[model samples]
Target: MGSRTQDTEECYSYHNQNQNVDYGRMAEILVRRAGSTDEFTRLTSITWINEFVKLGGEQLVPYYADILGAVLPCISDEEEKIRVVARETNEELRAIKADPAEGFDIGAILSIAKRELNSEHEATRIEALHWFFTLLDRYCAEFLAYLNDIFDPLLNALSDPSDAVSFL
Candidate 1:
């Protein structure tokens, strides 16, 4: 069997061939698997996504929105293990030094978060709010440009049935 380092190198090399297709396709796959009815499948996909984020580096910037959209809902997954891995993956993604020049699509991410804020799932809505907080913290100027677009959702969510969603 290959050493862990060798295995990781192989995975990295395999992924680096074409950033656009590889990362985008992988994010799409993870999104589908994360939404699986089977708990094990969801957990496995979340774990892989966490590793993928760690290994993909700046090449992932273009697909950041896709990855975030895929994993954000998992943060509130019914399975505790899935939730934990999903949160870790999100942290890893946030830590990535995404250069805006590398094509980070904040608009797409904002759109996803906005849609998520109206979700039926309480946890999903809560996570979406947390996403806005993170965005405001990191991309304050860019986020302000979309303030009007987001204002209505934030206003509506202020009256959410779940106190947890509104309070956060």
Candidate 2:
């Protein structure tokens, strides 16, 4: 276990030096790991994702939509540290400007965000709303087709017991 931790640290220490790394695959693996049932596993995955965003920066724009899909649920994780790190990662991904022509699967992200809006966790719902806002802000044209699908969930969220979820 300690060796694994040392190896992870060593790998991240040389993140910039390792230009040949297939970050897209790494992001996909980490995103899948982020969904683990174990809290420790989930937190570790998100932390590595945060580090990846920092190391890869604009180079990671192609994966932003998919990465956001994975991180959205972590916004409401039961673990506070996981929630914090996920939010930070989400923010970094959101700040990056990727061209729609780059073939981003906005539809996939919207599907994930819409599903997250229905999560029992209030934080998840709030984060989902934030996703809607961000998507609309950046891709209004692509988002238009999905407008119909969102109304029902948005209305349901309006009555959510949590004011934060409803108001946001």
Candidate 3:
């Protein structure tokens, strides 16, 4: 119980809230040695490294993009931290004319994106829309015919009482 509390608090300790040089090098090491050889290493690569980048800044963020051979740790990633880095990496690549998913967990992303897109909260809606747009933009050909279906719930949102919701 004591360790659990410490772990939870340590997860986002203040010291980790920036792009610290020490953490960046550690993230690089984790990303490089990330292999299917064992669960611990894989989890380090998927979870801790991404957490480092999320807590760190732009400098550390770049290494996450180089980690190759993700077996779905991004799209349907079990850890939120992993998913965040994956999304960030996608955006970076999109800037460079690269496909975001990069052969990762493309299958499960759509359902989660759709569910989040209809969230009642405006902030939730905004974040979800970002993901949805990335998906649509990355795979324009595949998502074209299904835009209406994907965007159906948002249609009624056109008349939402809140300016933010309605405008979105």
Candidate 4:
């Protein structure tokens, strides 16, 4: 609102910008990283997911869904950044498949989201809710079929004491 306040917000807008990973080429390496035992690599693979999806253009999902599923558990990873990017990448893949030129199974994708919604880890459940809400917003009719199945998770999420999760 004030000039000084605006400048302060801009200053905090970035903490690091020296990243130089060749994300384009990183696509080839990402499949392995997505399935890696090492946390960092699996986490870092999320960024590559976006790059690969973008580079693959339309109808590229069937090839990548398996790899993306492998990275899905990273949403429950201990490291916070990994959880964030795993969710972001999931959104990107969903978008890529939104109007796919090739058929992709919606049920398979939704199954993972359901499991994540009920994850023992709080953050994972929260992350799944974030995606579930977005997907419902974008494709409500498709997801409506699962309303019966999703009721328990939604009720559990509603009772969560975390203000952020409940506010959703």
Candidate 5:
């Protein structure tokens, strides 16, 4: 009976170690899956942003940035499904701006503004320009300069119809 109890203890320890190993592997898999360049990942990001915005707790801001970074580059992606990711990103930015917290990064906002201005879609360009102007009004000297660098060409492009603007 004494030997059986020792054996049982060893077996339980082994089982716990195996569980830990499995959990570690599962965590890695989940991270990779979330980071995947697939439509499902993009959809999940969109859903997460929508939900996060609705909840609007302070803790989720960094998570918002993380998801945005992961999904923003896919804005110009060829896949139609992934395009929704960009739209959601724009919406998330709009939501963030509505609250106007101290933690917001002007540089990142400016980058998105430039991308929107350069978008091939006329509607997106217009929307992007609107946000650019809003940021310009709120931010200081350096941000204004950044805004000018992006906005000047866009204004020129809009004035001159010869320039092709494609959002895709």
Candidate 6:
């Protein structure tokens, strides 16, 4: 087991050294692993996920966006480490929403916002929804129609039982 773990670490190091590797694919696998039920796999994957997001820049924004979308649904992650990962993921999403690029996908952003609005954690959920509103206000007419379409669902969800609803 020690040798296997060392081998995995070496492979990860090798990939990190190869700057030209397909980060999107690598992130996708890590995201999948993070969702796994196995304790070791999930913890290891969360580490990779956090590392992947921390390598932020214009080139990595898309990958971070993908990671946010992939992990937002894991609101039930009990481990403190995984929760920290989720929080970091939320922060990254907010950053992306604040200054989205031409390549940014509004649909993907909305999906994550919607997921957050439904989160079990009140603070995280409310913050996510607030970020959504901030994004809407900033984008204005550009995002008006999309906001209109989602407003009803968001309102109804907010009405349902959740700590986030009280703050709404």
Count the clashes in each prediction. Answer: 0, 0, 0, 0, 4, 0
For every model shown, what is its TM-score relative to the native structure? Answer: 0.79, 0.84, 0.41, 0.62, 0.49, 0.74
Q: How accurate is candidate 3 locally (lDDT)?
A: 0.49
Expressed as tens digits, the lDDT of each residue in 1-168 for candidate 1 is 243345345445656664443655566666666677878777877887777787776767887887788788888788899899888888787777566667987788899899889788897888888878888888899989999999999999899999998888
- Per-residue lDDT tens digits for candidate 3, residues 9-52, read 44445335543346545555555544435544455455655555
| Model 3, runs deviating above 4 Å | 2-102, 145-149
Model 2 Cα RMSD, 1 decimal: 2.8
Candidate-wise lDDT, in order:
0.78, 0.80, 0.49, 0.60, 0.50, 0.63
- Candidate number with the higher TM-score (1 or 3): 1
Of candidate 6, the 10-residue stretch with the lowest lDDT total is: 93-102
- Summed over model 3, clashes come to 0
For 57-152, candidate 6 gives per-residue lDDT tens digits of 444556654676556654347777777776676666556543456466656667677766766666556665765676677776656658766787
Q: For model 2, what is the C-alpha lDDT against the true structure?
A: 0.80
The model with the greatest TM-score is 2
Best by lDDT: 2
lDDT of 4 by residue, 43-74 (tens): 65665565556655443555544545555677
Candidate 2 lDDT score at position 73: 86
Q: Rank the candidates by lDDT, best first.
A: 2, 1, 6, 4, 5, 3
Residue 119 CA error for candidate 1 (Å)?
2.2
Q: Any idea what lDDT model 1 has? A: 0.78
Clash pairs, candidate 5, are: 120-165, 120-166, 120-167, 121-167
Consecutive 10-residue window with the lowest summed lDDT within model 5: 22-31
- What is the Cα root-mean-square deviation between model 3 and the actual structure? 10.8
| Cα deviation of 22, candidate 1, in Å | 4.3
Worst 10 residues of 4 by lDDT: 9-18
